[model samples]
Target: MSQCLNPDCLHSNPKGCQFCQKCGSKLRLVERYYAKSILGQGGFGRTFLAVDDFKPSKPPCVIKQFLPQAQGTATLEKAAQLFDQEAQRLELLGKHSQIPELLAYFTADNRQYLIQEFIEGDTLQ
Candidate 1:
């Protein structure tokens, strides 16, 4: 299942598609994970339920796209700092059983993304 990253897309494209069916957004990320669906959105970014294409079973993972609501030079710097801080926190907390494990964190195509082990359950609403 290829997920369209375009914020306006309403549907995901067919599996293995290079482009999205609805908005024509790229379907692959970092040439490994395949965005399957929108998991949720927050003030900082949107999370996607993705699959690790590099894995044989295509294990599910959470992909966090950094799309901060604030847009200024200083704000962007702070966002990046916070993002890195969170990544470090996750890396430390990953040793525990409660929090999800951080899988990868890097920038691609000028966009920042953080990948982690997906935890399956209802959100704590």
Candidate 2:
């Protein structure tokens, strides 16, 4: 069962909740473990290299947070929608050698987060 990550949430069970029973915030997909180390930060947002809590022996992951400034008013709503839509698209593109797998996507504290399988020993500068 998934537990609500929102601290203010009263409902913790994963059974019948669409949103937190107490605060109406969306529940977070719990990872068994993750250690985030900042990879880089830019006007767009920050990138982190996170060790998978679910499988520590396995490689880490890359998580990117989109910056509000990068998402301007002209495209805020549309960008947010597309950001989520692209994550879904990546999920469908799973395990392809040319495509990095999409691990998870959720919004917390009004910011969207995307977690993707990390390509170890890779550096983008």
Candidate 3:
């Protein structure tokens, strides 16, 4: 039985609630599925490289959780909405080889997180 991570969830059925009863967010998985390693940190948020447990043979993925500082309540709310929207957009772009696929989006403990496919390659620095 997996509990819905969305705070706004109305249904209490942890085992069968896929979408939040109030917001309708798909809520079957959470961060524990990934093996996280801190990759970097910046103004917007921190980046972590995590193993994609959902795919047994697949490579690791990246999860970015945005920082909530330096913004007013309205700005934060807008950013949250935009973040979710971008996740949806990225999910649609997942088919392309150049685009990283969006895996999940959820807010827990007052922070918003976005999980995406980690593209493995060299970095110029």
Q: In model 3, which runs have C-alpha deviations exceeding 4 angstroms?
A: 1-31, 123-125
- Model 1: which residue pairs collide? none
Better candidate by TM-score, 1 or 2: 1
Which pairs, if any, clash in model 2?
33-53
- TM-score order, best first, reads 1, 3, 2
TM-score, structure 2 vs. true: 0.58
lDDT of 3 at 35: 29
Q: What is the lDDT of residue 59 in candidate 3?
A: 67
lDDT of 1 by residue, 50-116 (tens): 9998999989999998888898999999998899899889999999877889999998767788999
Q: Every model's Cα RMSD, please?
A: 2.6, 8.4, 8.8
In TM-score terms, which candidate is top?
1
Which 10 consecutive residues of model 3 have the lowest summed lDDT?
1-10
Local distance difference test scores for all models: 0.85, 0.61, 0.63
- Estimate candidate 3's alpha-carbon lDDT, on a 0 to 1 scale: 0.63
Tens digit per residue, CA lDDT, model 2, 1-125: 33344434434545545466667665433433232356776655666665555664856777766654544576787777777787889898866766778888877567787888776555422
Of candidate 1, the 10-residue stretch with the lowest lDDT total is: 1-10
The predicted structure with the larger TM-score, 2 or 3, is 3
For residues 1-125, could you state the per-residue lDDT of candidate 3 as single tens digits?
33333434423434444555556655433634342346776766766766555676846777677674567989888877777787788888988778877877777656778888787665312
Give the winner by TM-score: 1 or 3. 1
Residue pairs with clashing backbones, model 3:
none
